[model samples]
Target: MIPLQRPPLPEELVERMSARGERLPQYRGGARELWRDSRTIRRELSAHLVAMAAGLSRCMYCGDSEGTSIDHFQPIAMAPQRAFDWLNHLWACAYCNSNQKRDLYPMDRDGLALLIDPTADEPADHLDLVLATGAYRPRTAKGSETIRIFGLDRPVLERGRAQAYVRCRSMLRDLARLAEHAERAEAGAVAHALTVQPFADVLYEMLRLRTAPRAALVFGAETVAGLNMLKDPRALRGPLHN
Candidate 1:
């Protein structure tokens, strides 16, 4: 649901992969490693863990702090050929990655994949944001399996999301009050006040707990820049209802 940057493999790491016959065919001649070199696996996976953290800045499974490993949605041990596949990896909180989702993959009635790839799209689309409980429920069978397979409804994740949703709502109300009170000429002042206002830091810190508000998370210094990019100046100044 968030913009993520998966950095390219380092040259040194690539060289090491090439040193051994690691590059192999996958997913119909996918330009990937054929066999995983032990050392390369350690180095690449470690860095990937960092990049994954850097990507979402939190655990993909539960939106917690950086987890211990890069999750192979299709377990690397089982799908060793995909050990180096880019799209195959995901950031996993330690517990959910290992204890809960160990080697388990889900498929729908027709046996198609039924899991949410955080790297692909927002989880909110197929799932509803349950404000009362902060758990994701599939409006359909596929969604249910995704919720189960990815542990989207786990108590910890639900609580974190609930807290985040509350914070986001609180921030919106706070901004709305200020905007309503400020006169049109004081738009500049209102913007400044927004920075020092409560939860401003939380809003701007792009990479944070996933339980953090996904959209409002970008209310950073960059907001000023984004304001300029808006076609209508008035559009830049609106209450945070959304």
Candidate 2:
């Protein structure tokens, strides 16, 4: 998972959400009912979430399947007060929301949640991506819990990430070549391609490790050169860096 920035909601939308949250306790039908009742607000929220999501509205947790649900980061069952809070909502795929994560939320003794909030925390700070095998190596307790809760190392996801790593390397090489020829249009197209694919963490990890010791050995000299080419402002732009 990469760090996600939550965009500011309009005052009107924020007020709507706050009002709904305030009335959450009065809803005899509970959070689910109230959530379903706000179809218009939900639709608008979903649109903004998709706009902020990586690569064709991919799940914020897994970054694999298309995000089809608006999940409460802090489960409504556990934190009813945050039921309508925008900060507690996350764009997620059906599998991650219903199967993997569900309502299981683990917290530390200090009352801090163990689950990594992609919008609030940088995932790389807690979890390390093993590029060679496409598995997550936890660097902290939070990372371990996040991986287990989200099933980040599941076989399908691992396979996809492994494949993505190879594809990203090839794309980077193409991007470097295009940039060398001052083909701004082609380079921009390549940059766009790099950001739009699934398993975006693969590309992110590659870029992160570009300056690590023996990075050339890990990503190969040519791929490392390509990764370095990203420093050129004219070579890449837009969501690739964001």
**The best candidate in terms of lDDT:** 2
TM-score of every model versus the real structure = 0.59, 0.94
Query: lDDT tens digits, residues 1-242, model 2?
Result: 99888999999999998888888888999987898899989999999899888888999999999999899999988988887888998999999999999998999999899999989999999999987789999999999999999999899999889889889889887877887788868888888877788988888888888899999887787788777766556445543463
Query: RMSDs, each prediction?
Result: 9.1, 1.6
Q: Give the per-residue lDDT digits (tens) of candidate 1, residues 47-77.
A: 6656545223366665555566667777655
Clashes (N, CA, C under 3 Å) per candidate: 4, 0
Q: Rate the local accuracy (lDDT) of all candidates.
A: 0.53, 0.88
Candidate 2 CA-lDDT value: 0.88
